[model samples]
Target: MELATKRNHAGEKADLRALVNGQYKGDEHALIERIAADLLAGVSARAGEKPGAGKIVGLSSKAACREIASRLAEWLIRETDRAVDARPSCLPAARWSPEEVLERTGMSKSTLYRGDHAQFYSVVPPGKKNGRAYPAWQFIADVPSHLPHLLEILRSNSRMQVNTFFLSEQESLDDLSPAEVLAGMPFEDRQIVASAQQRMLALPVRARVNKVNALARMEVADLG
Candidate 1:
């Protein structure tokens, strides 16, 4: 009897021609399909039958349905065994690409290339090719140690409040007035806004004092 072809989660039909031609050496696809078909048929038959009436729907008897289910279970066991035996030797370890590493780390390309602290992380060159791929094992090994610091940085970065007045990377820090900063801050942290404003006010004053001190030192040197 011809078996019904199965489709994947994406609704695309699974290619079983390769398995039928012996190109693949596993019966998992066939076993799963057979089991699913049997279950579906059983459900349909049960739905058609009235409860407590003991009336057979599609099958000759309930015993026939039980036999079909038992056969499917046996076939599943055999297929599972075949699948286990067909697994490749290099199945445990899988290497990830640079893009994947970035995704996991949440670090930008620049940050990954040159870390924030200049020498926190090191990149290993690809083994087979001269490309920019690191060993997945190395990433796994280093994660436990580096993760805490990375998480702290990410947390602090997220907490930082930015607005139109406050330019983080460039522009004037003074451009963002204390009131502006307070306005941008989340409502929950509004109580701490006063302290933040005081700190911001101190920064420009400290800068001005430093500039005056430098000028005074230059004048002394010139006079001498």
Candidate 2:
């Protein structure tokens, strides 16, 4: 209903709750997809009736379809994760090139492009081709001090996981993002290092590569 009616945030929350709590329920993932498609049909019908007003809420058809698809994908993933094994999901919100990263981190291009690129940062395949882009979270205040060291202690290797560790929230640090805490200099680093050590002990030694790869796959499908 929210997708079809183009409701605002609060309206969407209400509609979503009603939809979830209503009499209709089936395979959670499939039901959401089917409902989304049905809503999209209503959207299409509205568009067909008035060519210019088809957008329903001033959004282009392509954009609306993309939004619907991503919402559905996210719903499915969330439900699936709840029912099965849960995993960390890092939003690939920003990517920077070597030059941009060098400018941000004040690190040499040689170090960034080194054989062990995963040590300092995680690289994503570029949309253009033939190059990799670094996730911006790898560096905070031009420092990657905790990322490399923390990732190593986890016995997990991946620049993407490194970024995830930095981005993950730490309760010991009063719900602060690890990167935000790590960015603090001098006198503040004791807890930062201690929390990193404690979290490292808590983290299981498993292949940390899957989460980033899954995130990238979602992007390729435009479900990001």
Candidate 3:
């Protein structure tokens, strides 16, 4: 019975080895080395176990194969963790530029120059003569959160020419309504008016309304 059981277990172990080797997509040589190490450890452990006569007997091939599989699974997990840890945490800062910021914010050339000169947002100075220009990391750090506001401002400015809108100040404010001011425009102009309205709604109510009113005034002046 013991001999029969050993044969059955050995067959099952061989089947498992074939399946593992065939289905596994990782480095087969590395996996084989790890399995060999595990089998050696298992042999050493089994050697510590004595029979009734006091002679130590190592594990059978089936038990050794099982131990190898277990160890290989553990090693793969550790290797995956190490690979993930080896990757960089943040993108390199050298690739950012003022042109990227302008594209992202959709600001006019005048607005971009004004923002740069006024120091409204920080900028990285071009280092020496041949070095590349890059934006200050902090300026870009919060850009994701600030994008909606910036886009709204851009949309509002774009509508002024079509809606015949004007601004009292460069920045938008409250108490402005493009809908009321641009009521008489044709359907094409109304689309611009509607777009401006949507952008205004996303802004602080006071600033949005004020900007819309300013744009309407500018539009009228342009018509005159």
lDDT of 2: 0.47
Total clashing pairs in model 1: 0
RMSD of 3: 24.6
TM-score of 2: 0.33
Residues forming the 10-long window of minimal summed lDDT in candidate 2 = 83-92
lDDT of each: 0.36, 0.47, 0.39
Count of clashing residue pairs in every prediction:
0, 0, 18
Model 1 stretches astray by more than 4 angstroms: 1-47, 51-61, 85-91, 95-224
lDDT of 1 by residue, 121-169 (tens): 2233435534454333223211222222332332222112211111221
Colliding residue pairs in candidate 1: none
Error of 2 at 177 (Å): 1.8
> Per-residue CA lDDT of candidate 3, range 81-185, in tens?
444344322222333556765664444667556543222233234454442243322232222222223333434333223222221212342332333322211
Who is ahead in TM-score, 1 or 2? 2
Better of 2 and 3 by lDDT: 2
Question: If scored against the real structure, what TM-score would every candidate get?
Answer: 0.21, 0.33, 0.19
lDDT (C-alpha) at residue 58 in model 2: 68
Tens digit of per-residue lDDT, candidate 2, span 1-224: 85655534433432333233221123445545545655666668765744223564667655665567679758554544443232112222477777786774445678667623434555566555456777654443322322444444433435555455556655644454555444432223234445554454334323223332333343334521
